[model samples]
Target: MDTYITNKIMAVITTASNVSPGGAPVFKCQSKDDLYSITANLEAILDGIAHALNDEIYIIVKH
Candidate 1:
């Protein structure tokens, strides 16, 4: 099987102000891919959920 990788961020979802030990949300996963790929990844990442996964999701491009 072939794999596609283009710099990704390891994301985590939480449901509390302070995530204690053994209480951290699962790692969702983020990326620094192209616009189309980024949107598609975000869409799939946030699918079927009715709550804000995190405080914010951002990226910084160094160029």
Candidate 2:
């Protein structure tokens, strides 16, 4: 899923940059640390999705 999502994001960003004026467009991060922060947030979102999918709610409630 990460691969799918990251690839899609990259494709979109790449396309935008190519057609963008002066080759500058989208994803404005001030520094590498900011980029890392964004990645950490993305990982947390993916982790939440995984946990939600793997959750067994009804089974636990029945007991």
- Per TM-score, the best of the predicted structures is 2
Off by over 4 Å in 2: 1-26, 47-63
lDDT of 1 by residue, 1-63 (tens): 996533333333433335433422343334334333443454466442223334433331111
Considering every candidate listed, which one attains the maximal lDDT?
1
Report the lDDT tens digits of candidate 2 across residue range 1-63.
353332222210111223342322233344546544544454454442211111111000000
Candidate 2 overall Cα lDDT vs. reference? 0.29
- lDDT (C-alpha) at residue 41 in model 2: 57
Candidate 1 stretches greater than 4 Å from native:
1-33, 48-63
Worst 10 residues of 1 by lDDT: 54-63
- The Cα local distance difference test for each model comes to 0.36, 0.29
